[model samples]
Structure formats: structure tokens, C-alpha cells
Target: MHLPFWLTTALLFPVLLYQGKRARKHTPRLPEAQGSPCGQYGEGTPDIRFLVLGESTAAGVGASRHEQGLASQLALQLRERTGQTIAWHTFGVNGIRMGQLNQILASMELPQADVVLLSMGVNDTTGFTPRHRFRRQLLALREMLAPRYPGPICLLSVPPMHLFTALPSPLRQIMGWRARQLNRVYEQLARHAPGDFQYRSYPAITDVSLLASDGYHPSDKGYRAIAEVLACEDWFPDQPAP
Candidate 1:
């Protein structure tokens, strides 16, 4: 319900509709990364439990296996930086939106984690979810996870779609605009929540080489770059690396 999004959609509804169909028809459907969704890194009993939950990117669509995916790469990076055992788990569903995640979480018997990473926004952006609804679902998700996790809940900012090589011109432009708007909402929510919520801006992927074959999701190298940046964040200033 951001004003810009409404205005853009109103002006470009037809072009957006046509381009959306064309993009879907041309884009290849890549499978999620293979292998177990949960694993541990480094030595010693896991002192840090990390969980990644969200859409295709969280599910590791572009990578060949879980090891090469975002969650795994992040776990490896954290293990290296902290020199402590890190346990990581991911639950990613292709093309799923934030509201749908609530149902999934309610159904599953999840594990306790020390830190949570949420990868979302792409699908919501594409689906044209109203800003108010997106914010509500996000707050609800945080409420559901906070009591169980008892740690920081970091939400990764939605990628800038205008930079995506796969999407056609106007479509990419509109998507990017929407993405920026949604990210603004994320920043506001995080600002208000203080210790309860955190938002991390994504490193822009401008190079085509950083994208996967479909030109949408991140390639292994892209995931690695993202993980490196995230793992280095001062999320655990109080619990310094030992």
C-alpha cells in the first residue's frame, strides 16, 4: 500500500501484465539445491544454532547442493569467524510468500536456534503484496519465532530487482521500485523493534556472472559473497568469538 507502488501499478498495469507472462514463459524452472537441509560446521558442540527460512533463495535454488547454498556458506563463514561449532538448518519452499510461511511453521515441529536469518521479499514483491499486509505477516512471523529462538531475528533486505538481468526493462524497473519500497518498511520495523528485530541490506548483484542460469537467483559465488558479508556482521558483539 505504498503510494508509489499503487501509482506505478495503475500506470503500467497492462505492460506489467504482458511482461510478467513473457518472463514466466521464458524463465527456466531451476530445482532447489540438493542434500540434507540441516548440518553442523567446525568442531566442538554447536554453541551457535543458525536457521534460514524463506523462499527459493533460502532453499538454495541456484546451487547444486546444500553445502554450496546460502545457509551452508553462512554457517561455514560463521564457524571460521567465531572459531566455534555452528549448526545450521534451512526450510525453503520455492515460490512461497510470507503469509504461507505461517501455515508451514504451525505444522512443523521445529528446533531451537540461537539466531535466525529470514530470506524473503522477492515473491512478495512479485506478487504485489500490499505493504501493510507484508508488514503484518513479518511481525506475525517474528512473534511466532521469538519465544522459541530466544535470540536475534535478522531479516535480509529484498534484492533490488532492477539489477536483475533476467527481467525485461519496465518490468525490472517496477519490481525494483517495489522492492525498495518494501525494504523501507523493513527498515522502519527493525528500527522500532530495537533488540527484537534486525534488518541487513543485501549486497547488490550487478554483474550477470553473479546470477544463476535463470538470471534471477544468486549463483554459488553470489551466495558465498552474501554469506561472507553476513557472517562478518556484529550480531554477537556481546558473545565475542573465542
Candidate 2:
């Protein structure tokens, strides 16, 4: 049976606070961002501008090269699916929070895009963003990206943190709860968002081997796997599956 929120938080607080230090100690020094020169490939008529925004996953921390990262994998697959050129760009830092992202976008010239894909939330969970604030920032993000793409804005679900091999005991449990709670908010938006905000349900990644040595971020193989799965999803009504 689930304990009351107050009781649960009180019980877990001290242990979780210590585990946070442990998590940092165990994590490997992250690789450089693999988003620059962003995956601009695939040649055909009618170029489709694809934008990937948000967090380290979008910036591709674990993967060694951008080509092996999610952005490139998705870009290649999109090219195959559409039989059109795809120019994909990824913009994000390793530890960005939602509010930071919101501020960043507000100051920049939002690029035009036919399709916009996103990866966020895990950091938000770790960064201590409240659920309601997360929802608000997420909605604000969508509002900003919606008009740029004006076609489909797909938000990938928060990963299942409870299962991560990297996190210790109560930390995993606590983070998992946070991830699940945030996921519920995302799902609600997918169902109710006025326009084409889709909560793309990314497959659950449980295999530790596919993850980076840090045991947190996706490895090259993991990024490729995720990208392949995303490419297969019918992002458009009549678009054929890969």
C-alpha cells in the first residue's frame, strides 16, 4: 500500500539526500554535447526541418558522436519514412531545467520547423521542479514550439527511473515516483491539448547494457534504438510507419 505523501516524503528525505551525493559520485564524467553541426543530412526535394530541443538527451550526452545519437538516428529514419530531405537540429545543455529552457527560447529567434521532437523531464525531476510548475513550464514550451512547427509537437515521456541501475535504493524509488507523476501530467496534455501536442510514448528502456557507463544516460546503441522506435511512430495521420 502507498503511504501518505507527507509520511513518505518525511521517511525518504534523509536517505534520499545522502543518495544524491552517491549518485553524483558514481556518475562518469559526461561526454561533450553531440548536438552541434546538428544532424543535417538526408538529400531529397522538399526539405523538412526537424528540431530537437530540451535537456541532455536532446543534446546527446551519453552517445559518443552526434551521428550515433538520437537526433541523427531520428533524422535518418525520418528521411527514409518521408523520402524527403531532413535537416535536424538539436539545442540543449546537459543540466538545463524547464524554466531555463523557457528563458532561452524567449530570447532567441525560434527556427522554423515542420516537425518538432523533444526530450525533457528527468532533469526537472532531479532539479526539484514542482509538479504544477513543471506542467506550466511544459505548456509554455509547447506554446513556443507549436507555432514554429504548427504541425506536430511530440513530447517524449519521462523515463522510468525506478528501474535505473545507477540510482541507489530510496533515490530510485523517489525519482521513480517523481517520473511517474510527471508522466501523468504529460499524458493529460496529450489527451487534452488544444492542438497537436502529442505525448509520444517512448518505449521503456530497462537494459542497463544499453545505457552509458554512467548508468543514467542512453548509450550510442540506446540512442539509436530510441530513434528507430520514434521513426516508426506515425507522427502524421497518413504517414507510413517505418
Candidate maximizing lDDT? 1
Worst 10 residues of 1 by lDDT: 233-242
**Error in Å for residue 19 of model 1:** 0.5
Provide the TM-score for each candidate, comma-separated: 0.95, 0.91
lDDT of each: 0.87, 0.78
The per-residue C-alpha lDDT of model 1 at residue 91 equals 87
Backbone clashes in model 1:
1
| Model 1 error, position 59 (Å) | 0.4
Off by over 4 Å in 1: 238-242
lDDT of 1 by residue, 1-242 (tens): 46766887889999999999999999999999999999999767888888899999889999889888998999999888877788999989999999998889977888768888899999999998888999999888888887687665788999988888799989999999989888888899889986767898768987777788998888999899889988778766655653
Q: Write the per-residue lDDT of candidate 2 for residues 35-78, one digit (tens) a residue.
A: 45365665554376777888888878888877777777888887
Pairs with backbone N, CA or C atoms under 3 Å apart (clashes), candidate 1 = 1-131
Stretches off by above 4 angstroms in model 2 are: 1-3, 44-47, 194-196
